[model samples]
Target: MMSKSNKMLDVQAMDTSSNTVLSVRHLKTYFYPDDGSVRKAVDDVSFDVQRGRICCLIGESGSGKSATAMSIINLVDRPGKVTGGNVLFGGRDLLTLDTKQLRTVRGASIGMIFQEPMHSLDPVFTIGEQIVETILAHEDVPRVEAAERAVTWLKRVELPNPEAIMTAYPHELSGGMLQRAMIAIALCCGPKLLIADEPTTALDVTVQAQILRLLVRLKDEIGLSILLITHDLGVVAETADDVLVMYDGHIVERGPVEAVFDRPQHPYTKALLLTRPIIGQKLRRLPTLHEVMREVDDGEIAQPKDWSTLATTVQTDGDKGEAHSTDANGNDHDSTPILTVRHLSKYFERVHGLKGEGNVKKAVDDVSFDVHRGETVGLVGESGSGKTTTGQTVLRLHSKTAGEVLFDGIDVFALNNRKLAKLRTRMQYVFQDPYSALNPRLKIGFAIGEALLHHKLATKRDVMDKVVETLELCGMDSSCVNRYPHEFSGGQRQRIVIARAMALQPEFVVADEPVSALDVSIQAEIINLFSELQHRKNVSFLFISHDLSVVEHICSSILVMHHGRITERGTVDDVFNHPKDDYTKSLLDSIPASNPKYRKIGR
Candidate 1:
């Protein structure tokens, strides 16, 4: 076995002559808030990126992953400053370099791919113009040559119709196209070191898979070193040769990918690994970070009650269940279709050239599905595949251009405003972004209780009690009702949102990307919560998500969508084990296996 010092990459060996591309030691980045206190965003962090190797930094939001990357690039702006650290690139200390010298090295020697490509790209300029600017900034290339190079890189990234896309603005391109554009810009200068921060976080599974493949291919084709920062373990398992796990501003774990995953030494690392939802390994409940590490748990995370008993109550108390479950022969047909959508279509008109007749974009084209009672139906697809639009159209969140929606046998599309408003009490929607879901000024209690009162299900005096009960069902407590959305963490805020959605005791719900933004640990918690809710309340869910691994865990039935059409649909085992369509196969292929043993070669 290698010694402790040999277990990790050594920067001392760099010695102004080694092949280490970038090395950071004892890095400290702190911020001074208005409360007169110092917050260490990155503390005592150390890592190295070697030549032609991919080193990944995995952590949740505020775990100092992005801060560390920005610090390496010396881009930390005001109020936040790098207090102490040594960043050595090509034997030169980056901190000691003047602005002019650092500028020269920025793009010429280093390239960066940001998490959100749209934000980094200029809205007014075409994609080609941006790439040309990058090339000209670092090299003495002429305008025509730079433009040609831009088109070449776009084609290299496998973007469709590269030349046509080059002349389009950022808004004119799709999410995947824009990301490829960003890659073209970053690589136009031919840098040696690539720093990619959550490059595929917001993309669809297929697009994300394609992007991951492209990055790996680029690393090999160029023989360049890569420093990847992301929270997705699947991405790390597939792309990383070395791994760094961060938590609360500390490098809690570090080693080769196989070594770290096969034998996780740190409690945080172990918990994070356990928290991820694998293909066939299902856990009873996903524990939080506090459960794994005693220091972070705060002793207040809510525990779930027996879910079977909860479902029994819903079945016995509600008269609707009995009415809907009986067959003509007096036998029970419990697997009744609760929500039915047929030939549903949603479209938007796009105005061109400021005045001509608009072009119609069919967001949801002839979609159809039936969600059975007590069963979770997963609507899986890539971004712009029309999954969200289908869900919204079924819920009548947006008026459908065509087709029919049946909720418990009532024609939802034919219902008038008053009837539709009344029907909404039984059908609800959970938004993707929890941080923006709840009202900022409203207390948690008000946010939840408003739903109860609006539906006339609870009195003014009983609303708080109902809110508390809903919160409890969601693994929260009455104490949380007094807090605001901003005070809670991302996972906690999602719980609050779930609590509000369930406050009306809705039988069917459209949950859109519910846990995509959360850490794996928190994701497990939410999934467990959903499992319990499903078994207890028997509430059917139309769970819409871009992540196939996550959808594979909680969904009983899966529907695959691509280009606004349902390409495939079946039970989890039938669809996942024996995929039929090409698009479906690609989605399954894209799911990064959680285990290192399953890591594919040349990903």
Candidate 2:
């Protein structure tokens, strides 16, 4: 069915792959702030993603990894301008393309899978309609033919009942289902390249694994090049052929995946890899970005004045203080039990089959956990394991179908509306995404200060003082008070979220995968910030994450969830050392490490 000439061209492309499918040279993306200066988001960065190999664009939040990805797709809107450099794709300079020309190549030549599936999907459109629309946009294909392709692609991505899913709206689908649907839609256009920007950041561990495997399989089958923008080094080890390390809008290092991991030439890359929580590492506080940056500055490289000044600022008032409680071992562990859940359960109705007999899906089944005062208790599991559900239930965001949630020994579920509102003052949550969780209309000062106003914690004058203080406490400056979340970088926004969380000086906090959305180094800083807050404020934490390494790093105690049940619970050392549950052992073993040298490329 394939034309001889087209097949020849494909083979030729593979043979001359060294020519580079996409080459970015001296690229600079600048955001002109209202103050008239450029932000220099992606400054003088260069890298190449080959025709058949996966290229990983790695960085911490605000290191400009995502900005580079958006720039390549011409998705950088106004205020943000591509100030310089060439984005060469298939020998053609994409930077020179007009709006019409860019549109012609966008979905057809390059497909994009965004970070959040929930926000990316159109609320009104059915999943099938979205996929079909994507396909027909590029090619004038028949509706029936496009629909069939959509179904097949959905099934290929391991979605169950493709037909049923096709008819379902995005809201009706689970997080994993919606993500798979987004992938199916992206692939519908048969693009030569795929830009996956932290695509698995929102999914749980098992689901994230499945999605990564699916992408690798698709790439192997079709030889479609992938540009994976992620902060997860484990993902790079598992999926990338070559790694491009970005720091401060520049490529500090680039090499084969194994080489980068095994013998990292850059100090920043080395710090990122080691600072990450791994199975064997104890749940101890990691060094802050300030510390790492200091080390980098003091080491072989001399500190630039700008970086030196920034580091000085972070040390003075930026660190809020540790949030973890000390255990008997003098390690970070809170034994006070600030929040405790006993036999908590939540269920949902799921349509069974064609007979339409709905079955109750036990989302959180008989799950029990404890969050100690001044300690971080990590809740980790696969997507369907109900980690988020448990967190939400503890927060009363989702009413527990059965069981008791006690906050500071007070029954949270038993509290009246007014009592609950009063109780909320001492408890807060930080979401995985700062963009969605934040009120865009409110300035950073107002958003962080709003909680103080609601709780009557401070007067009008005190509010501004508190806002500036909170911002500084979270590693930001007083000057950021009037700035909106949109005006800040991803790392800055996350810091603002942390600032907001600290506004009330709450005794307990639920940090739901806060760092999973951040780049590795940014994650390190945030984790350290949480550690500092715990020590200083003595607040307990329910740290929910799919990333085991991160959990191992920050959590004093670990609760392993499987199929909505507590499979294992123990101190970081006990669980990592013994791992009584086979499921827990399996999860630990599944983490991708630095690839061995000379292993088969595609196994």
**Candidate closest to the true structure, highest TM-score:** 1
Candidate 2 weakest lDDT stretch, 10 residues: 1-10
Q: Which lDDT values do the candidates have, in the order given?
A: 0.81, 0.78
Per-residue lDDT of model 1, residues 1-603, tens digit only: 112211232223322337678889889999888888998998988878888989999988988999999899898987899999899897788878889998988888989989899999999999989999989998897899999999999999999998898889999988888888888888888888989999999887777878888888999999878999999999998889889888878887788898877776665676577567777643334444444444213332122122222222222112222222111121222478999899998999988785677888988999999988877888998878898989888988899898899999999989999999999989999989998988999999998888788889999988888889999889888899889999999999999888899888889889999999998888977876786676677788899998877777777778998889999999877898999999888778878867667866373
The collision pairs in model 1 are: 290-297, 311-536
Query: How well does candidate 1 score on lDDT at residue 279?
Result: 74
Cα lDDT of candidate 2 equals 0.78
- Model 2 reaches what TM-score against the true structure? 0.77
For every model shown, what is its TM-score relative to the native structure?
A: 0.89, 0.77
lDDT of 1: 0.81
> For each candidate, how many residue pairs have backbone atoms clashing (under 3 Å)?
2, 15
| Residue 470's lDDT in candidate 1 | 93
